[model samples]
Target chain A: MLTDSDSRNISIRAFRIDGRDNVATLLDPAAPGDRLKLLGDTELSAAPASPAGNEPCPEETPAPVLAALEPIPAGHKIALRDIESGEDIIKYGVVIGRAAAPIRRGHLVHIPLIRSLYDERSGHLDPETGKPKDISYE
Target chain B: MNNKTLSWPAYPRKDGRKGIRNILLIVYTVKCAEFVARKIAASFDCPDVQVTGFDGCTDNQYAVNLLISLIRHPNVGAVLTVGLGCEYVQAKWLSDIAAAEDKPSKSICIQDAGGTGASVREGISWCRGTLEFLSSAQTVPMTFSELVVGAECGGSDYTSGLAGNVVAGRFFDRLVDAGGTAIFEEIVEAIGLKSLLVQRAATPAAAAQLADVYDKMLDYCRSVGQYSISPGNFAGGLSTIEEKSMGAVIKSGSRPIQGVIKVSQKPPGKGLWLLDSTPDPHPVQFGITNPNDSEGLTALTSAGAHIVFLVTGRGSVVGSAVAPCIKITGNSSTFGRMSEDIDFNASEVLDGTCSMAQLTDRLVNVVIETASGKLTKAEKLGHFESWVPYKYQDTGSAGTRRCEGTE
Candidate 1:
């Protein structure tokens, strides 16, 4: 439940599709230290980032505050909870991919950091152009 | 919601259907005839004069069926078939069908016409006269109930599922509720939502049809070792095929799906219909299904869609040959950058600037206006592209038959 005050202070937002989702999608680009107000599918709103000086009021903040641990692009995913290496990275309440390395909460979750379990080449693309790097034109 | 009774000006076809555009379609029977056909269409600056055809020299029933469907599509007012003398799919055969349909039609054989220059001149002359006659064709008032709209998504990002497709879904629901036909294709994209898809069926038969198609799609993907997820999708924040599928399927809306339909087949009744364009499994898996977005749009257009909505979160510029393509993007930045190409920005829903209902209303207005002769960005920019590839899928009645050997 987002309080009137919490809604007022929200400069950035992220959407969590389902309650069981371990990741949320950033609605806006964020840098380290930016607070993301978590918006869920229903009326539930998670607490604002703690480091931004919003004290955790239990009733208003059923979920923990998430601060950007790294620079994340808009439309990208962010880790809502600490994920171990090789653990499934869940989104839409389904395993979208696996964490290639242990990801900290609020850190950017994307290719190279996370790899698709179905397609091995998902991690082997050129990050800048999103083109397959290993394939030859021959 | 107040505009539920809104009607648009549309040409009434001889077959009791309505056409939003009075298109002069140039059909090239083979790759050899393409140059002449394109040259003829290029002579005219009118957007209504467009070109589409198969490139193969040999016979393909699927390709022929698709061509026939295009000739008979409600939007096409006139058709001119061009053939290189020896192609198996004769230009005269197609012209005869158009003539039977009462559409101003003609056929030209390049070899018999003397050469490319002579054939182009003959085609240009016929098109000029035909366009003049079609320009004065009377239009009747077409309501939502008589409309058939199709939707497809490409170059998708995270915003597609969250905002773009969601808005499209809402609009589809409204369209279906108003008793219009809505068709959505790209069955390969629905990777992990078999149960969800089956549950949306309007009848038990439709449910079984959805399940069978879903199973075949999965098997086809497994056989090819490629799901529709692309590298650009990953760059745009989609992580897996299942994740992408969930996003892609949302554009179909929550309406009770009428049933599954094959390519070049019209929905028997009004409501939502899923078009399965996946090639049937064979001893050797051959033609790539929907090699590009244009092919998917063409599939929908061949099914009699008057206008097609192309939702692309990352943005796309291509349009279809028969139906006007309305490009939509949920990413405001992409819409901003590609404003000339993209038609609608559903990003307002994501930005909290507008509610879904409000945005859906605005989208409906766009559709109504487009149906009334307001050109979409694709049409205005002359982005009419169609791809008809050679793929083997049974053209039997929808939901009545499965791919050969699949049973």
Candidate 2:
């Protein structure tokens, strides 16, 4: 069984790769206590882990919490951190895109979903503050 | 420590070259004479007796030389030439060339051989006898190092660079390290990447040869009144010719190019070499040569490839006549859609589940297994196709030169 070392309530939903990867992509917007299976049919347990100082709210948080802890839908990517507008988006350990706005952990990352999420866009977004909402490239 | 011994079979040719396949070839000298050759081959009713095309006038040394080299290719057990009798490309020369190489060959000039009726009968006789000899041939054990691999990229996408082609490059590196040959062609698609490739030349002479190969392609592309990338490449999302070439060049890997060879020329040793493939755009005259990766692949295979490793991103279904093509795909979507067509999926690298080296190792094993008689998807589907050679522009003043370096 695989488990993340934080909140016990939320679990990993599904893993797209092996445990050796620095990051395992969420298959269905993972929660604090969901079971995840890696390739080759290996299974593991995972729980939600928080930033060093951030604590869980007294109220129960929804799975894949976004900006102000919003819930992102399936096939959507969430920010792993509070990404500032114009910062490079790294996926698969490569620079895939730059943030169009300040995005908080669990905030949704969606595009046309044609070729790649990062294929069309390039360059950094203008510097801004607060949990990033819909910021368009000018 | 001892290395594990491996086994392979060798079919020796009359010219002393070792082959991996015994083929009875019906070669069409011109487009006007294609139907005659095909009909004769079909009547012969042997899959191994296949039709290969080349339309060269007798005056064209390059075309004639290429034709002679192919007719006597190691894989070919025998040859039959077909022509209209009045064409500048003489059938008698082909017959003589094959006979000189000790191959059983016959030429049927439609006019002199008493037109279609007599020509078909005579050509059919040659095809039957050639097939018989080919069937009776024995196989001898050949080594891994003896195999030649052709690297071709068609129906490409961005993943081609990030996954399929790059992984193929790694495989080329390993093959070179192990003293095996890798051939990379479609020089038109390889232009902008030549600067990077010059670093991989094994010697100063080879480096100069590499430069010549680049210049010839650029010159041809310019002279041809068109750019190398077609509408297909543009639709595939390639912005510029250089961008497309950058992806194509990765298939050669990081191996030092030992020499530059023509379409008919084989590599001298176990190293990478760029094949000069800047051909005419007309498929009718040139017979589906340039912009047709399948034909370029077939040319490479006929040159003596035991297995052809095709890397695609957007996806292609074409295969070769002379060798088993192992298709490696880069896009997860493409692989998923055409899993039956693709042999290996390096797209696993994109998801970060597997490293490039890991995929390369797996691919090399695939090549080894394929060379040992594992039929590829195309082979099972009977997708054997032929291609035409690219014709380069002649510089009235700037002629051909010889290599000044040592062996």
Candidate 3:
């Protein structure tokens, strides 16, 4: 009895964490060629501090008309607007990661493409202990 | 925010503290005695009994202090300290601390007991008898303020940020509102935002302390050449440390931090406190900055956390030694997949069907039930895994190591 992601159920497709965030999180997986409804809210949050974030689309969002560029998974980020390289990728109204490359609207925001700027360390895990190796200022 | 009030039955500790779970906790002073200590606890076949220990074979004040913290936790009604007999972290000293505090305590060494078999026999006898005596202690009614709830998120995913941790955050806000202590850790999660936290400190001194801890945490991670995000975090949809942190930090709710304390220190008063939960990252030490779930739980328990709320997305099955861990998950798939392991499902919040308050009510009910001694998945499944830190920052610079990718 599990319902899948649809535009009307914006709750299932995407969630915006903060009004200032440029990305939205998908709650369920979707396929290519799927038309989606995205948030249009420029005011307050929809989910209001719930992990659902601000939501699939905000209150003013229109019905499903936007097409999926590719199949997307649940909990992954979807760029609502274009993100230029070196610019901050904002979520929760703060910078989470940075764009290592230019990201177009509707593209999936994830690792490799979007790099973590937390530190300069290479964050390699120790094969022997499964712990992370040390990074230095050098 | 219902005005619905409920009282919890609590076990009184001699130190003027209260405990939700009365435990006959067994400790191994060194790794060599771990097996013997484990055998003694398992041999008792009792859920009220548990085992954990430090791994250092040498004398480390940090290790000993951490051990003392766990031994003195309110949830631990009695204590049993074991050692290989020659280790620097003495079991005798720990036993004395317990006895001085008027707790029923015993100490043994395998090398002194003439080996593993004889030690196990004597240890089991002591554990059983201690459990019997502790059971007879008087009980009292407890409330939210009497509780110290530790918040942690492992196996984190985007759902964890959005719903799993969000639900826990709401719970923390409520707990604080009710005058209870709530803790949210993992400084690596706070990577890019030091001033933001500094602005929330209750006092100038605490603000300094908070900043220091954050700096130390960052340096520690840098010394070890690792960031806090794991491969699982990335694979599960979290891209960067800041991103993961934004999701993770919400679990503490929005409260002015009372103060900051080291991993072994206690929260000064109440409200929300920050635990410098990381092990000392001194360049000469052998342990890393990142602690697994068990280590974190034990540290919190040592700081007097009566219960732990573990919010996981990829779904972790870990339970701690001294305190009971309540599993709250925001992923429906994870919940359904590991139904037996998860305690509360906040997935509906993500689905837009269940409200955070509804999830809070469900979670609180389970916590009350757990406080009354209902077994958790980790307890039911004998998941008493533990980790004691060993490696710390090495001397000087080995070289410039780049922290690139999910290496």
DockQ (model 3, Cα): 0.30
Error of 2 at B205 (Å): 1.3
- Which ten-residue region of model 1 chain B has the weakest summed lDDT? B398-407
Error of 2 at B380 (Å): 3.2
For candidate 3, give the docking quality class from DockQ.
Answer: acceptable
TM-score of 2: 0.69
- TM, every model: 0.88, 0.69, 0.85
Q: Give the best candidate by TM-score.
A: 1
Pairs with steric clashes in candidate 1: none
State each candidate's clash count.
Answer: 0, 15, 29
- For model 1, how does the per-residue alpha-carbon lDDT over B1-407 read when each residue is reduced to its tens digit? 34557788899898989999999999999999999999998889678999999999987777899999999999999999999989899999999999988999999999999998999999999999999999999999999999999999988888888878877877888899998999998888887667668877899999999988987887777667777887777776776676788778879987788899999998999999999998876565445767889999999999999999999987899988989998888899999999999999988877667777788889998998899999998888888899988888777755443444431
The CA lDDT of each predicted structure is 0.83, 0.61, 0.73
Tens digits of per-residue lDDT, candidate 2, A113-133, equal 112221222112111111113
Candidate 3 stretches with Cα past 4 Å from truth are: A1-12, A37-66, A84-86, A100-102, A111-113, A120-138, B1-5, B279-281, B287-291, B391-407
For model 1, the stretches where C-alpha displacement exceeds 4 angstroms are A1-10, A17-21, A39-64, A81-104, A110-138, B1-4, B284-287, B397-407
Q: What is the lDDT for B7 in model 1?
A: 88
Prediction RMSDs, each to the true structure:
5.8, 10.6, 6.5
Candidate 1, residue B47: how far the Cα is off, in Å: 1.5
